[model samples]
Target: MAHEGKADEQLFQLLANLLHQVESLTNQEEVELRTKIEALGLEVTKVPSKSLKQLDELEIAKELDKLSEKLDNVDEMISSAMAADPQVQSLLSDTADIWMPVITASADERRNFTPSVGENSETEANCES
Candidate 1:
């Protein structure tokens, strides 16, 4: 169906944009944090600590592994819960089917939601000005 295709396209774009925006914001935050760290005189090379560890590639890989393990635990918990209760399983299934569209719709709604546009005449006048 054309409607389903359009919805799928919107969902895909939403996910892609989300990933891009998150990465961009995360990079900005990393830059700010690094600046703060440098200001604090805690540069990795300057700091003298016996237990100091640089976040190198291997460390990042290990962290990724831990993240994967945590996700697996989450999946296991979900599967276990679904197995324990048919009603939960059904509800989850329904949520998966219904919430996807609701998520897109709610996102659109929030994006359109405006402030300083109520029935208050003074507030509307200030906003317009």
Candidate 2:
């Protein structure tokens, strides 16, 4: 009977120690996860019951409709302004002439210009020196 009681006591102590270790590990993991989440610029918070509300779908739809109409009006105004501006018209008409040669020259130079890997490192070292 004495030996059985001693065995039970030892088993309980071992279980208690294991439980404590598991709880410590869990707490450490929770702290690390919270720190990582905070570092990511995200808010980790609980919402209050009073602050939580269902979305008003009808209101959202109405607001989106109003926004769409406003955007269309703005687009029309921009088109009218562009049509009225001679400089804008000239730029639109001459876009290829103004941009094509410069773009083509850059592309041709890039195709021809292959620098050795060591060349870049040497240039960087020289600049640092």
Candidate 3:
């Protein structure tokens, strides 16, 4: 009935909102990571060309590796959020699966009962008097 449809709409809206939130979080993380990488690149570019010692360069590279690991963690978190978000959608999907057929059959029955304007309405009016 109307109630079930309303419930479905609410569920769909909730799931959609959650998905959008996760997407926004991912975008924010990407922007933040890009900024970090650009800043690090600028810093590395400032290093003196004369003192190109392997050990110092390796240490700087290790710092970049740490940043990379942090990015990986952010990615994992986003993946986890996405994975969990599906549970809400799955429930809504289940509701649709069980109720959609019944709603369709009821709608069909209602359509069948509706009289066409020309013949049936006139016949029914004649019978009523």
Candidate 4:
């Protein structure tokens, strides 16, 4: 049981490391995409200012809506790029392969682990007999 627990911990760590790598890769890709967009003369404002009190409510709302649309466009561009990038697709496939087995094993373990409710009851009953 102790060994099994250790193995599970190791698997969890591996999964966490893989996920972190994927996240880092995604952030890098997004930065690259933003750079490309900026290169094409579109201003990529990543951090929108929250100080909209100076503007009227309608103006603030309009600004927010505009920012949302810009973000959506950026996302669409990134999605299209990812779809065309074979390396990104391969990395995603490899990650899925590594992730699936661990997840399936965890689910199977959870399903199989049933606690015995009256495990000691039988011994006590035999002693009484």
Q: Highest lDDT, which number?
A: 4
TM-score order of candidates, top first: 1, 4, 2, 3
Which residue pairs show backbone clashes in model 4? Answer: none
- lDDT score of model 2? 0.43
Worst 10 residues of 2 by lDDT: 39-48
lDDT by candidate, in order shown: 0.46, 0.43, 0.48, 0.50
The TM-score obtained by model 3 is 0.27
Candidate 4 TM-score, true structure as reference: 0.33
TM-score for each model: 0.35, 0.28, 0.27, 0.33
User: Of models 1 and 4, which has the larger TM-score?
Assistant: 1
| lDDT tens per residue, model 3, 79-104 | 66447667534533544533344334
Which residue runs of candidate 1 sit more than 4 Å off their true CA positions?
A: 1-54, 97-129
Error of 3 at 3 (Å): 50
How many clashes does each candidate structure show, in the order listed? 0, 0, 0, 0
Instruction: Give candidate 3's total backbone clashes.
Output: 0
Deviation (Å) of 12 in candidate 3 = 26
Please give, for residues 14-55, the per-residue lDDT of candidate 2 as tens digits. 323333443364453334433432432222122235636665
Q: Which stretches of candidate 2 lie over 4 Å from their true place?
A: 1-52, 89-129
Scored by lDDT, model 4 comes in at 0.50
Clashing pairs in 3: none
RMSD to the true structure for each prediction, in A, is 18.4, 29.2, 23.4, 18.2
